[model samples]
Target: MGNSYEDECRRSLAEEQAKSLAGTNNWEHVDRERVHQDWDVLYREITPFLDGGSLPGDQQIQEFVRRHFDIVCRFYTPSREAYVGMSLFYAEDEAMRAFHDSYHPGLVEFLGAAIKVFAEQGSGFAPSAGEASA
Candidate 1:
């Protein structure tokens, strides 16, 4: 009796999540595929820069930052203000923070700074509230 209600609630939550993802670009074939590929590709581009030391405004770093910017825009289509709010969530949301931090010791902080640079200078700086993905 005690466990039945909890099980039903869990099932309901799972069903809701499935429905939500099913209707979004998040789970749709093309966008999900693109994001997965870029996830790896971007990591490759940024990892070297992360290890190389400073985020100098060289062509490569700029390009790396640009990719990040474009991906965010492509995903979130956020206005500038929404982008800042999303960045705050990325930094503060415990689950997101844990996911980012797991990548490296200081990856969360590094990405925060990098995102700032990307938004502040990149041509596609618009951010939207519902656009950002995990």
Candidate 2:
């Protein structure tokens, strides 16, 4: 099958959403090397919002993971069949938790809303409350 414009649009939207959440147009600066070397910095920079508890951080994580992981699943068919993978790594790592906690409320809410818009306009993959249960 061929890739669709909808797919391209979804990816573009996701990248934009992630960039806005990170408060930088420089997300390209984030990669495995950066994630490994500066995770603490990234987490510290993004946590307060995740911890605010006004909006659900887990749900935001779920949607982000789902949209990104779906692209992975299209290539690696056996990785899993879920919209969002287990989020097991996020659960097992303290730094990941800290990263989630660091998100500013405004940013987190914006991300959540953007994810909702992406789902509605593109994928229709609304994150169930249970998906964020972890």
Best-fitting candidate, scored by TM-score: 1
Best by lDDT: 1
Q: Write the per-residue lDDT of candidate 2 for residues 22-98, one digit (tens) a residue.
A: 66444443454644445344435444545565343355554553544444333232112122222322333577444
lDDT of 1 by residue, 4-79 (tens): 5334434443443345456664645447678768865776557666777866455676677667667754544545
Error of 2 at 56 (Å): 2.1
User: Model-by-model lDDT, in order?
Assistant: 0.58, 0.40
TM per model?
0.60, 0.27
**Candidate 2 minimal-lDDT segment of 10 residues:** 77-86
List runs of model 1 lying over 4 Å from the truth.
1-30, 56-59, 127-134
User: What is the TM-score of candidate 2?
Assistant: 0.27
